[model samples]
Target: MKLGIDRGSLVAWDPDGEEWVVVGEPWNHDLPAFLADGEEAVRKAERTFTNPERVSGRAPSGLPFTPASLRAFALWESHMINGAKGMVAAFGSPGVRRLVRGFEAVTGRVPPPLRPRANYYREPQFYMGNHRSVLPDEAEVAWPSFAQVLDFELELGVVIAREARDCTPAEGLAAIGGFVVMNDWTARDLQWDDTRRGTFGGVVKAKTFAGAMSAVVVTADEVLPRWRELTGRVLVNGEVWAQSSTASPLHDLGAAVAYAARGESVGPGEVLSSGTLPGCCGLEMRRFPRPGDEVRLELELGAGKPVTVTNTLGARPRRATQARHTEVARRK
Candidate 1:
């Protein structure tokens, strides 16, 4: 069953009615309770229905789940290698040499030629994001005041169904509840600035802004049959910017979740994202989106229909007025 939030209420798609039916209480108040209930919560949504509502006039397409935490990983080798090369070029040869020397000194071993990207092959690289910044598909992304270059990453997101710690890949896979098409909006300029300063945590500020996701969540059972055949695409202003098969990633979702749960607890309602797919971002193509441009992401999960999310770029909110306006516009 597909689930979504509608006007602050938990809702499930009523295929027979072709409308969103109120399944439970408002998500903000019911999320914790629902997550604690796990599969029972889904079963309840399936059987229980109150007010049936049509989605025709809804402003922001409500999120399927409000994640307790958002964690994203770089699971594709091509994206990592190309991104590393871009950063190296930006840093210049002298800076790159110093970076390599610093790594060698710390590890007491000669670092590979592509020092940083090589490290990605050792394990899945992930970063925590601001959960509060999650947004619905129709939301407009305000250009961050501190960012001059903005990009969108096409990805698949897994919603955890249960708490997992020090779990194996198979266990991690079993913990997945559902999947969504994710658009990881990024402030490329801020990311570059942070990387140059040797502070990787800058991703929190760069990536936390109004990232978009599909309106409905598809259960694991619905996705498993087509998991290896999923394809992802990114379009900017109606033109295809990048395309890739989800199966092309070097690391799978299970490994990403296992790595994320190593010594750390990943709980239900937390989103684990399959990072930018190969060639799915401007960092690799040297092209970035500008204000007024529309970015769209689609993930074909072979569930008869593809999950899609779209966002329109707006100017940076440098003043309180613009900020409030953006917020109001997002809820339209």
Candidate 2:
């Protein structure tokens, strides 16, 4: 069943009626609370919504939940390799330069011009994002003044159903509650700067702004049949920039979940993303978003309805100190 939040209440879609039926009140509990009860909770909710006292006048298309934490993984080998090469070229790190040359000499294959550290290829790499920064589709994303290059990453995300730790691949697969399309907005300039500084903190700053997600979360059971062959597209101002099948993911959902759950508990309402699909980001295409640009992402889950998310870029906000200085100068 599709789940969503509307008017601060938990609601489920009644496909036959084409409206959102309230099943639980937010004042009493949230989606996480229901999730803690697992499949039985979902079944009970489905039954309760069948004859609810109130139904939304229209279909619910709000965020399913604000994740407690959002962990995004680099599951596309191409994206990770190419991104590392681009970063090494842009930043010119001495150690990386020597490493790339040594790798090319030993392997007899032209290594990525700037081979990333060995750990990147040894296992999955992921970073935590600010969950509070997540926004629903159609929200206006602010273009931070600190950045010059804005880009969008099209991804597939899963919400955890229960707390998980030290889970095997099969167990991790079962931990997933639902799926959502994700548009991870990025500031390339800031990201590169942070990378160059060797701190990697810039990744957090670049990624934290306005991560857009689909309005409803489609249950995992509904998507499992066609999970490997799912297709996705990235559109900028209605123009398609990239399209690729998710079948090429280097680390599938099960592996990604297992990696995240290793020695650390991932709780309900937390989001885990299967990073950017191959050729699905502006960075790979060498094109970036401008002010007032609209980025739309769609993922075909074969569930009769594909998940889509859209966000429009707003003009960069003026720095508070600069705005105050300008006001004082104008007054004088």
Candidate 3:
């Protein structure tokens, strides 16, 4: 069933009627609490909406709930491999680009090292994201001032229903409360530098500045089993940019969550993303979103309505004057 916050109240979406029905009392905008209640919340939404406690016209949708924590895992090997090639094409130094092109021209494939590491098959690997920076669907997303090449990644976010620690994969799967379409906004230029030079190995400024999630969420019961059959598309300024699917991943979200819960706890309302879908990122497509572009991510899961997350890119900020490191060193 479709669930979200509408007009400051928890509501269930009726696709056929195109209306929002207020869920019963005690289920306010507290989505984490609702999810912590587990199956009871679903039953309440299902039953309460049956009689129509209160109905309202379509209003601006709000985030179902702010995530308690956010973790993104890179699961698709093809996205990684192709994304590497696209990076080399877009940001690699001239000599490196020539070498890569020559290597591809001769071998007809990206170098073996560029492929997903064998350890990726052995376990789930991920980076923590700034949960507080998440933007709602249809919200205006601004590029971070320091970045020039902004990009978006179409991904699936799994909402954790309850606290899990040292759990089995099945238990981890059971912990999923719902799923939401996710757009992981990236600063490609900053990411390139951070990836190679930053003391911290993985993405930092490139990813954590901002992200977007669908205003509505589909219950896990309705999505889990059929998730692999789902397909997705990315559109930039109303034009289709790429097509994708959830068909293959070295590790399912359940495994990723299970691995995450090895020692630390993965709590309710924490969002764990399935990383970028194969070919679903501008980084893989060789075209990035510019300011004023409307980037929309749509997922066809056979749900009543196709889940979509749309955000309009905002203009880059003007640079401000600042003292250089060299000047500071000289003064010291």
Ranking by lDDT: 3, 2, 1
Q: Number of clashing pairs, model 3?
A: 0
For model 2 the TM-score comes to 0.82
Per-residue lDDT of candidate 1, residues 262-301 (tens digit): 9989888899888877888877776677788989888886
Residue ranges of candidate 3 with Cα displaced over 4 Å: 15-17, 52-54, 57-60, 320-332
What does the lDDT come to for candidate 1?
Answer: 0.71
Every model: Cα RMSD to truth: 7.7, 6.7, 5.6
Best candidate, TM-score:
3
Distance from true location, Cα of 161 in model 2, Å? 1.0
Best by lDDT: 3
Residues 1-332, model 3: lDDT tens digits: 77778777777776656777777368556766676676778887666656644566354386888898999999888898998887777777678878988888999988875677777879988989999999999899876777777789999999998889999999899888888999998877777667667899448877998999998887887789888878999988899999989998878778998999999898888999888999998878777777898999999754566889999989878772221221211100
Candidate 1: Cα lDDT at 259: 94
Against the reference, the lDDT scores of all candidates come to 0.71, 0.74, 0.80
Instruction: Assess every candidate by TM-score.
Output: 0.77, 0.82, 0.91
- The runs of at least 3 residues in candidate 2 whose Cα sits more than 4 Å from the true structure, single-residue gaps closed, are 25-29, 35-57, 84-110, 113-116, 317-332
Clashing pairs in 2: none
Where is model 1 more than 4 Å wrong at Cα? 14-19, 25-60, 87-119, 201-204, 317-332
Please say which candidate is ahead in lDDT: 1 or 2.
Answer: 2
lDDT of 2: 0.74
